[model samples]
Target chain A: MSEHKNHISTYKSQILVLLTLIMLTVLTVVITSVHLGPFNTAAAMLIASVKAAIVLLYFMHLKFDEKIYRFMVTLVLAIYAVVIIITFFDYLYR
Target chain B: MTGNTSTHRLPSYLEYQGKYTGILGWILSTDHKRIALLYLYSQLFFFLAGLVMGIFMKLELIAPGQQIMGPQAYNALFTVHGLTMIFLFIIPGLAASFGNFMIPIMIGAKDVAFPKLNLFSWYLFIAGAVIILIGIFSGDGPPDTGWTFYAPYSLKTNTNVVLSVFGAFVLGFSSILTGLNFIVTIHRMRAPGMGFFRMPLFIWSLYGTAWIQLLATPVVGITFLMVVADRMLDIGFFDPAKGGDPVLYQHLFWIYSHPAVYIMILPAMGAITEIIVTFSRRTVFGYKAIAMSSLAIAFVGYLVWGHHMFTSGMSETARLVFSFLTFLVAIPSAIKVFNWTATMYKGSISLEPPFWWAMAFIFIFMIGGLTGLILGSVSTDVHVHDTVFVVAHFHYIVFGGAGIAFFAALHYWYPKMFGKMYSKKIANWGLIGLFVGFNTTYMPMFFLGFMGMPRRYYDYLPQFADLNLLSTVGSWIMAASLIVVIVNLLRARKGTPEEMDDPWGGRTLEWKIESPPSLENFEEIPVIDSEPYELKSK
Candidate 1:
């Protein structure tokens, strides 16, 4: 009810976002075909994250929505990051 | 007129029994209080089922070799026991039952934000339980893998791992929905003047627990599905022969499970805080510290899952880091315990059943927590990793902390929840018997584990037999005590002669409402005008 008017994104914005997501997906597939070895996963994740940010901001409307929603997403990502790091701590070190 | 009104009150939640009719009214009801009672009835059944399994297991242990059940049967019983207790009883224990009942009332809401979703969660829980039961009958054999259902054997065994694990996964969904409902309810539903800090410590703890239930459960849910995938499909997710590491399964399982421990205990801790402050006639000491500590515990709990895997062939550095994190998580827990003690100091106190249980909680919880240090250390855990010590330690914390605290909440809120009063004298005797019985059953296991008796074994050497017998005897006493407690409460279900609001002189918003609460939980939403837990000295 705290309104800036639940901003509905325009169709142009939606189409542009969709195109960008498709381009990123193709780019990730092309990149993975080449062995960047250690950087392969890192690069893919980075690009995929950009795609996620675009989707979250535009499609999910976290961009125009309240700041709290954005903070929650970041916090969730942080928890998953921690889980991955701890798991790899055992695998890589061992 | 007062007598007539009292007698003709239309049976607050229990007897009026909503719109539907008979059992349909209960299972189909959207009333949060009715849904809560539905949970109570169902959970009590599962609780007794788990208890019976314990008695049977203890009987089998009374004399070394199999007495009443076969070795395979023993495995099934204990496995079912763990599943029933963890999933069916404790995980949803306080939160689903008392949380559903109290949260909306405490927050001055009509009902939970999503009442239909709450009913759906209960139905999901029952459906999950039924699936697990079906797994027992339909499987090549009963699920013999312990509740952990650790990989390799879990996948290798013919016992219905897929269906049972599916059951557990379904239960996790139920837990997540309840958690989601509580979080939204708390955020959106508080009375006009109530701020976050102005809310009771119980609400803060429930807030912490909801986050855990929402976030942590998904990992276990995914893990179980991976198990199902590996079992049904040719997925080599956990089978080493199929090119997967079983350790990964463990890492995934404990990642959720370790935090899930708090999912059970944090709410119990909150209830303890509420009861202690109410009866002691004191404002809670370190209220912010206790509130923040719940969050700290939930946050830190996730990091220490590796401690459970220290001896699982994890790297030395991983072990060391997890060991450190394990110890780190304990600090917030210790802070809450200390704050509870400080709140009771130099305060006028009433020794109610809840208080008695809370005191015993601190004692048993201390034993459980201190022993956790032994398990937390990289070197010490290697010695007692799968021994009876771990069992005793777990039972102490889970059963003592959550289980006894459950009784504390039951006794503290009894008159309010049911609008009736039971015999406090009988409650005390039951408490004494339960306390003595509980410690007797589990204390020897610390020695048995130290003496090198491995857990999940159907038989033991002659040396461990005597202690096992003593533990079995303790089980009997505990069982008798539980009957007395349950019977006493059941008998008091009839409406009481006395008026019941603020019976414990509680300062929480729930205390301001009528006993048994209205269908909407409030005639009109109350305005919170003061801080939670303020009590006048008697």
Candidate 2:
């Protein structure tokens, strides 16, 4: 448990992560304005995922947590993804 | 152990005066035992409220035409009944009461990882209940939207949907917090050598349920917020005229609502596993299989929510996919049912009230589970979409499965929690009435539904009169038995404190402690050395 404390992010690193997230948000908005057709939604979601990844790693400290937390998150996200795909089955066919 | 011997036996949790005195002590204090009791009292209050509403609804349908109340009154009765039962009573029912009481102790810990958060969730629960009361009473009329609060009508209704939707949102938060607290506590607070597999099956059930609560509750919380916004803020979330897709609301609603069923039943199933293993005086067969199946149900439960929306103009492709997935979730449940039956195959079996309730759970849950398959089939569901059949199926599962298991576990742990033993004879009599009357009240609904009788109608055809009258009589017997059970338990609570630490000869860590355990559960944190349910050798 003491070893986990050593892995904590420094203030400067935390600031850098925050700045990167803000930059990604700006990029997402700018890309949405360009209208990449179907790819616009994909691009926004992709960039949003990157920003969320940064936040989850740095701010939430999942990076410093145990392997079990990572496994649980991945399992949850997988289920959510499957539900979305199944829901889209209706939209696509109808 | 001698180092702390004097402080250990000085006061049980009930007698130990915390920082505050009397009611504030319970309300403000963070003691898990007292908090569990708080939940028990409030849940009982709401359960009776829900039960009375159900009886009224049944009475209205007794003779078929204008019995006691108007159709509008019947609508309010069922709406409040559904809300009170699902949100107020059963959803948080077993988990809030027994889960809080047993989880930390079974894990060999002093309290949950976040004791303050546990107490706070209780407050949130109370706040949610208060908001719901305001929603029903202060409005122009009671929310007639049913507990589902299905859209277009929900938004368009003059009744106070806003307060009720917000109340559900708050209750969802309370549930999420409870789940989050359990997950962290189970991960971080297990005693010295208590491995995950070595922990009791009840904890494993809680682990699975906690995941569902954490992951799935947020969707319904957001969905409720959207409904409130659509009603109040003109956001057009589920309003079809405002370009909002109503089916989307159901998809979002069922996404959480379906797994929420697992959240309700998993702990009950887990409790039945504990009771069966204890009464049979044997090691649990297929421990990993039963534990893993809980996770499987929770996992597959998410995929199967689409079955509920099958007749709502969903695509044939999605409907077929959902039906298949619904059947898939049953495999894991069947695995548990089979495992429990096999555990009692060659063991020494004891006949107690808890054992009887557990057996009833198995029998009725089988009926419930089998009927679920019927509802899951797209073609069959099209025939009986909102009929009394769907109502009967879920009552068997939620009421028979979860509700009866709750009573079984309650009686099994009564001696432990309150340090008194209820009369075996009276309890058995009560069980007889409950079993007989329960079947009588609900079994006819399947036939009525097969006869094409739709549900939620205050006035029914004269053809349905005889069965409806029989159902009302059955409900009276059921209500009387419930009162008998409650009075029997109350009588037991007034007796002397039980001396047997392991009254039932059980092997769980909780059974190793004194009845009505002390404020800090253990004098010394126990070292884990053997299996959770190892029987004592004669």
Candidate 3:
């Protein structure tokens, strides 16, 4: 177990990430009031995914980690996206 | 003894006393080898229980009317049999038992990245098994939805679906933790000079399996929770009255269950690869291809889950796409089979017990895999969807693939694990009986299924009687053979060890150490210089 220099995030960056998350949450609620039929679920999911990525990158310290960690995150998200799309093949066609 | 400077032989993992003694030394210890034995014992016990349930079910299907059990009893029997075999035995069978024992040593590491977490996973495994058993014996009745736990029926069944689903949820957690432990261990624990490609093929297969365990298991775990929520709170996740789609539930279930099959078989494939290379006295052909193909199988396996849902009312487009993906997976799987075959080409082949078991695995698994393509096709699958053909295909794949490989790995590693050699002549008899009896039991089912016999039924048509009777007789032979195999291994437990350490001239790191390895596997981890399984003559 070798000790290395740690990347400490500035309060400004943390506060900015927090505010963006809050703004996205409000926008999610605001968008639900205006119905876009099928696009409503799509819109909300897109925003939620963005929020998740933000939390993963900043809150989870993945931003300061090795490149392999980021690659793994992308791989997991890719798998999840593929599952949802395959599932929607049934729903969209039906 | 080779790398270590210590003169006197320290205690082998079997006799090493920890914080506590006796059974406590086993159950409470964090050692990976001891934990593997714990899983082996528990798996053996549950496997016997499942085997008994299967025998009773086969007996019920023998003539036409109920032999000794009623319709409802037969339903419960098949349900519990699938549950016990799938969850408690085969799913964790090879990976938990042999993977735990071999992975760290094969990679030249002392222990897994998280030793305590490994022990905790075993405890969770037992807890989950206990909860499932309670759900069986103490409920309103055993779950009759079968192992797939298809929705709508599962939602309304009075037979304790909630408890069983919850128990499965817990078991999924254990799988996830063990998978996590292996991933971290393999990533961080390989000895110096060992690159990713230099590691043994068994480690590669475990790596692929661990990913499936970590990523795919949680999907089913959440799905099981939703089933429980539907029963307890009327949430209607799959309830038709509440506008929840039953097909959605099928989608969710197979999303995990399909990849779960890979979880069962990949480690088995890895074990077979080792046995094939060792007995052939040759280097594995297409080493990089075999390693990459494992990852390919894992990745593609996740996409083809919808093949299980084709007749379950999924859309035509989804079925078509899923069928294509299913065929794609066959490519990588075929790569492995060809590689194993090529490894044995013109080499100094040793007809050992483990090699015979590996041979049986290939032959049986090929039948299973090819029959699987028949089911993977949308048109043919629609015909044999719920028929005995599907059941036969499943048993061939899961039982023949993973089950046979488990025995292969046990025979290959037994001398190292327990420092005792099982009877060669008896082992040969057991394999013949198993192969002959297995084919007799399942081969007729394929014909019976093609002739239109539905599975999970207590009674059948008068015309179906002869084949069903033949299948039942085969089950009796298989059961007797299984007894012979287990008793032979058990008798070896008290026998003397061989003087040599590298009994099979194995090329892996585990073969380089003492038979029945020390407390921490290596005194000082040996540095690697060549590819794993590099034959000296070659």
Could you say which candidate leads in TM-score? 3
lDDT pick, better of 2 and 3: 3
Q: Of the pair 1 and 3, which is ahead by lDDT?
A: 3
Deviation in Å, model 1, residue B47 alpha carbon = 0.7
| Interface CA RMSD of each prediction in angstroms | 0.6, 0.6, 0.6
Estimate, for each residue in B1-538, the C-alpha lDDT of model 3 and write its tens digit.
1353435566899989878999899989999999999999999999999999999989888899879899889888898999999999999979999999999999999999999999999999999998998998886978989999999899988997888888899999999999999999999999987899999999999999999999999999999999998988999989878978999999999999999999999999999999999999988999999999999999999999998888888888999999999999999999999999999998899999999999999999999999999999999999999999999999999998999999989999999898889998999899999998899999999999999999989999999999999999999999999999999999999887775467888999888778798989888887777777877622
After superposition, candidate 2 runs with Cα above 4 Å error: A6-43, A58-61, B1-8, B536-538
What pairs collide in candidate 3?
Answer: none
lDDT of candidate 3 vs native? 0.92
Q: What share of the reference contacts survives in each candidate?
A: 0.74, 0.74, 0.70
Writing each residue's lDDT as its tens digit, candidate 2 over B1-538 gives 1112223464778888978998888899798888888998898889889989988998998996898999888888899999999998888968888999999988989999899999999999999999999998896877998899888788889998889889989999999999999999899898877899988999999999999999999999999988888878998977767778899989999999999999999999999999999999899999999989988998899899999998888898999899998999889999999999899999899998899989988998999999998999998888988999898899999998998988888889888888779998999999999988888888889888888899999999999999989988989888889889889998998877767467787878887788788898888887776767866421
TM-score of each: 0.96, 0.95, 0.98
- Candidate 3 on A15-78: residue-level lDDT in tens? 9999999999999999999989867887899999999999999998888888888999899899
Residue A14, model 2, lDDT = 86
Report every candidate's CA lDDT.
0.88, 0.88, 0.92
Runs in model 1 deviating more than 4 A are A33-39, B1-11, B536-538
